[model samples]
Target: MRKLTLLIPILVIALIGVLSSVFVVDEREKALVLQFGQIKAVKEDPGLSFKIPLIQEVVKYDDRILSLDTETIEVTPSDDRRLVVDAFTRYRISDVVQFRQAVGVGGVRVAEDRLGSILNSQIREVLGADQVTSDTILSEDRRELMNRIRNQARDSARSLGIEVVDVRLKQTNLPEQNLNATFARMRAEREREAADEIARGNEAAQRVRALADRTVVETMSEAEREAQVIRGEADAKRNGIFAEAFGADPEFFAFYRSLQAYEKALQGSNSSMVMTPDSEFFDYLKSDRAAK
Candidate 1:
């Protein structure tokens, strides 16, 4: 019974040791087997793997794409406009051995720190180039700038065993201190445009008014000239009729003139006239009396 008990305990310890020596690597993980703090093997493919029982170690890294969001950085374009830029990178470990050697067991965090610096430098270099203006940075062509940054950063990241898939500016904005000033300038520009439009409208209105006034003056002048011509023609026709009446019968014409004068002299109810007894004004009255 004592020997059996000792054998059973030995078998249990051996089983535990075997279990500790074996590890299963997931497909999403990349593993590095290290012996005495030195890399022994790199396992990229997913399967069951073996390591030394107590003296070896395995460090696993994600094989999938990783994201790194950099802190907001300030950059100045060629146009001399300062901007705050937030950027991000998509990357993966292309060489685990080199990555481990460069970062020295600090893991993804350390790699990201180094890569972030590289990306920031590339961003500044590309965005601050002589041909890159603020308008270009803010325009659709910004994609080209980002691609340039990615390519440039990729060259630098290779030393760190990093593959830069993409580099993008997540947000671009003016500094807080410049926001109010920029808005004020924009407001001033809008106001200037509005004033220009109003001035143009007023000029058009004045032109219309002047044209209408000129048209009205011309129309009134034409109407008055026609009225004068008609009045002159009517007066001439009346004068002709009067001359014909006088030529037809002088006595009747004289009587008609005297009758018109009496009508004018006695136009009011309280009318009065002072005249000599033998005045021509009484000729019509005397003729009427004689006829009676």
Candidate 2:
């Protein structure tokens, strides 16, 4: 019974060693087998792998692309315009052995921190170049700038066993201290444009009003001239008729004229005129034939 008990303890120890030597590598992961802190082998495929118990260990890294957002940083463009920028990076571990050598035991966290620094440095260098202005960074040309940053970062990250697949600027904006000032400048510019438009509109309206006034004056002058011509014609025709009547009967024409004159001179009630009794005006009033 004691021998059996000893055999059971041995069996349990063997089982523990087997369990320790056996390890699993997921398909999405790449692993480095380390012996005494040195990379001994790489397991890039899925399924079971073996390692020495109590002496060897496996460090796994993701084989798929990973995303990282860099910290917001302040940068100055060629025009000395200060901007706040943040970016994201897509990367993958290209060499697990180099990764383990570069990062040691610090793992993904340390690598990410270092990678973020590299990205920030490249972003500043590319964006702050003498040929790159704030307008370019804020325009479609920014894509080319991002490509430059990615290329630079990719080269720098090789030492850390990283492959930079893509780099993109997530947000770019003015600093808070400049926001209100920029807004004020924009508002002022818009207001100036509005004033210019209003002035132009007023000028056009004045031109239209002046044209209308000139047209009205011209029309009135033409009508007045036509009316004067018509009056002259009517007056000439009336004088001709009067001459014809006078020629036909001078005595009757004179009597009719004297009656018209008396009616005009004494038209209103209590109307009076100062004149001598022997005046020629009395000639018409004293004529008894005029009453007939």
Candidate 3:
């Protein structure tokens, strides 16, 4: 019984050692065994684990992708435009050994701080290369331009033992003081363009009116010339006919013309007076009387 009692105490100590050495790996964590403040082994799989009792230490690291939302950063473009840009990055630990060496058990914050610096330089480089004036980055091409900025940042971050999965711009806007200035400039430019268009329209209208006046004057001159020629031809033809008729019989034509004149003059008269009866106008009457 005394030998049994001594064996029981040894078993108890062994059980205590086993309990202290026992460890577990969760689904969201990676286990790193450190001995004497030096990394001994890395365990990635999730399961029960063990370490040297009271001599080694187990540290857990999150292996999942981490998200970092940086604050809105104000930047200036090459074209002298002020802008505020908010951004976010997706990253994960790539080199656990380098990570541990570079930073202690602070998993994502170490990477995040380094990434912020990279993003700052890259954002300046990218937007500095572009030409966005105060307003905003509103188009697809602008978004792509920002993505290229993130790409450069990712490359810079690789040396820090982290891989950038994605980067996105949450918002972009102009500073308070520059907002009204930008709008005013744009409005002035548009108004100037409109005024220029109106001036051009007036010039076009004047040109059209001048062309129409020239065409109308030319057409009217041509019509007047044709009409005068036709009138002259008609007058010449009538003169020729009258001369031939008058040359055919002079006395008969004169007598017939005098009779036509008397007929026309005597029809409108209610009273008539005879002036000596030998008047030349009575020739038609005297000749008629002789004929009777």
Query: How many residue pairs clash in all the candidates, one count each?
Result: 0, 0, 0
Which candidate number would show the highest TM-score if scored against the true structure?
Answer: 2
Clashing pairs in 2: none
Per-residue lDDT of model 3, residues 208-280, tens digit only: 9999999999999999999999999999998887677789977777777888887787875485756765678
Give the better candidate number (2 or 3) by lDDT.
2
Candidate 3's TM-score:
0.67
Residue 263's lDDT within candidate 3 is 77
Task: Summarize candidate 1's per-residue lDDT along 1-292 as a digit string, tens digits.
Answer: 9999899989999999999999989999999999998999999999999999999999999999999998888899988999899899999999999999999979898999999899989988998999898889899999999999999999999998999999999998989998899999999999999999999999999999999999999999999999999999999999899889999987788888888888878887888889888777777689664485
Model 3 residue pairs with clashes:
none
Task: Itemize residue pairs with steric clashes in candidate 1.
Answer: none
Residue-level lDDT of model 2, residues 1-292, one tens digit each, is: 9999999999999999999999999999999899899889999999999999999998899999999999999999999989999999999999999988899889899999999999999999999999899999999999999999999999999999999999999999999999999999999999999999999999999999999999999999999999999999999999899999999999888978988888888887899799877777757667575575
In model 3, the Cα lDDT at residue 56 comes to: 97
Task: Return the lDDT, model 1, position 194.
Answer: 100
TM-score of each: 0.92, 0.95, 0.67
Q: Determine which window of 10 residues in candidate 1 has minimal summed lDDT.
A: 283-292
